[model samples]
Target: MRAYIVPMARSLTVALAQYVPLNGPDEVEVLRSSAAEMCSAAPGLDLIVFPEIHLCGDGDDAPDTNEWLNAAAEPLAGPRQRALCRVAADLGVWLIPGSVPELGDDGRVYNTAIVVDRRGDLVAYYRKVFPWRPHETWAPGHDFTVFDIPGIGRGGLSICYDAWFPESTRSLAWMGAEFVVNVVKTTGSDRAQERILARANAITNQVFMLSVNAAGPVGAGGSLVSDPEGTVIADLPSDEPGLAIVEIDLDDVTRVRQHGTEGLNRMWSQMLPGDPLIDLPVYSGHIDPATWRPRGQS
Candidate 1:
């Protein structure tokens, strides 16, 4: 089946490096406006993925994430999520609200990526596995999740720092994911860094990797879309607020899983001795956002 995603980029365009500190009410309001813009860019969008915590700004200079996100965070069946889900269902497409601060069991929250299908039903949810710095304040996600977007093979889920881990991406691939969507709010990382990830993830798993980052101070807005063979087909400027829509063939996804003609063999599946990380268990609550399991290839 033919496939595509309208990677809606909004707010601090692609000009801000690292992270953009929320300047004022106007800057904070950009989050809500982004959703409206994504809806307008909706015509042929089969799936739309937004940036990580695109709803809330950074900590030091932005609005209170708890207040701002909680205000906007839909309670499983709340308004914000419902409105976006409505857009997906009405458009006969899939919607992935990259990341949000979801309320948890205790006085805690989860950095989560919530998914909705064409029917407006919440299919799967992925909590950020590798919580960023301040993320220590939030709840840790326990498992990796993959969701089928109707005709799409299987789509994987991860948030910002989680992109740093190969297991997070590969787990999705092993679970039958042909497309992996990595939602990021990277403020200080360079385009080169993100490029390495997209290309590596795609090349290793032989799957399409969509790296969508919030353009601002924190995420260093270098959003990218890579093919299964690990070739970067499209890249957005680090400081521009823009939307990138790409049409990708999923069949190519199968080839990348088991590298054939490509020069680069799968990176994560191979291992070596003396690599410090010797059979580490999944960290329960203190997992670092950039820590991947030593067994990405094992």
Candidate 2:
């Protein structure tokens, strides 16, 4: 396995903004103002993350109908996106403006996260691969995206339900991602589990994980940052809107993999002797029912 090294500054400052959920025309303005406040409060932050469906608020109370979700969805180049880009530029910071209900050209709505660079340019877009089953109306995303920021190290993007699947983060790590920004919209009941999963993902992948969740009655507001060692470095209040800022060393990713006993990359290389897992023709066909059944089953 090839070792990944950090080429820029050894450390980065990241801020997680636990945004309050509000529904109205002023929602965008509220977020813009909140982001500005966060920036002013914490100067020189390289990245600031918001919650899921931030512009169009998570539909916690709305009817479970596609009509409602499609109505809230907007094109990638819509005004909301442009406004967020402006916010990034004004603050002079890289921004993950959370997930948006995107109205794709195919006429289907997708839960998407748009990443903006410090210069206010849209750098990458990652659609959620897994939508919360039986409830979410958005389509699943087919691709995983990781991109580079000129000064900062490489980062990956994933939305709420995507983090539940280990392959989501694993793929990013395989692609040389040093850190992941996960934007989420979770209820109070799921907050604890979300934190556990965040820590697990960070530890197993040996990468920095920042999870930014929403606030308000519908949201749990447990925005947190986990280090490569699965430690919760910083966290915000679960019942209120706030910002959790922390400084992390990107070089730790390389250091951990190089020195740790059971690093993920080293384990994978050891397990897969020669051919890559994707190149193997396993689990592609149906299994025989009689070969694998419960001991008591007929």
Candidate 3:
């Protein structure tokens, strides 16, 4: 069984992550320090997940997402990621830092989820393929990304807003990802939308999903770890800061997948009016010759 530890995030109930930093200097310090502390909190687990934008108070003055994206962004190998890497190395666990704005070499910003292994090696970088509204300030990621994690099956990654679109998750499933991580920051409205993604993707792809979200502003605090059958094994307390621990066994996923909808999942066909839903795949027969985005974003 793969034991996963998810943070019970404390985010703003109605404000953005940036505003929560205004939540007192000590509070900001604790939020920024959460990942490193996990090294000691639960060292026995194989993996640990934290919410996106864990660094809340960087003294950024930008009023817009872009401005904040640029200002609060971290330099590669900066203190932030390095701190988490050290924890993974010391504890012999893989760590998924939900994600943060990264200032790339060319100075363009990108929303990135970096995966670090037990030895603390940076294995994969899952850039946000779709940056949501106000995110136009940062560059949209050009391609889908995935990689393997020992004992965790072929894991996948998706950042906030990316969950609303089916293409990325399908692309990962198509590429053989067995487990997917949806790490995000959300408010009340967005949280409901994300839950739909978790439930649907599990049924369609036969893959497990583990979500890490913030509690107050950046997220609704509904961190979850679900199976391929779309059954949530464990979850963090909603509207509060707490931890959710789940043991993910590869065999369990294999067994449930083999049984199909009769196994651990809720029948997706039952998704009715206003249900958080995943739509049937749409295959575009032809591109709009006028202004279709080139298949290769380049």
Q: Pick the candidate with the highest lDDT.
A: 2
Give per-residue lDDT, candidate 1, residue 187.
61
Candidate 3 matches the true fold with a TM-score of 0.73
- Per-residue accuracy of model 3 over 1-298 as CA lDDT, tens digit each: 4333433421111011111322334433454355446555554566677666655434334466567657767765887777767766766767775677788877888888888887978898877888876535667787877777653456788886787787787677656666678877776666776776788877676667777777764457777767777787766647576676566665554554444465444322233444443333465343222322112111
Q: What is the C-alpha lDDT profile of model 1 across 81-162, one tens digit per residue?
A: 6666676666555667667667665646678898877687889888877886673456678899988655446678877677
lDDT of 2 by residue, 1-298 (tens): 8465555657888888787665676676777787788788888788888888876654555665456668888899998889888888988988887888898999889999999988889999998999998878689999898988765578899898888999898778767788899998887587888889998889887789999998867688888898888888898856587878899887787666665524434332233234333432453744233332212112
Q: Which segments of candidate 1 are over 4 A away from where they belong?
A: 1-42, 58-74, 134-136, 258-298
Candidates 2 and 3 compared: the better one by lDDT is 2
Candidate 2 or 3, higher TM-score? 2
Q: Model 2, which residues run further than 4 Å from truth?
A: 1-9, 58-61, 64-66, 261-298
Quantify how close model 2 is to the true structure by its C-alpha RMSD in Å.
Answer: 8.0
Candidate 3 Cα RMSD after full superposition onto the native fold (Å): 9.9
Q: What is candidate 2's TM-score against the reference?
A: 0.85
Error of 1 at 183 (Å): 0.6
What local distance difference test score does each model get?
0.63, 0.79, 0.63
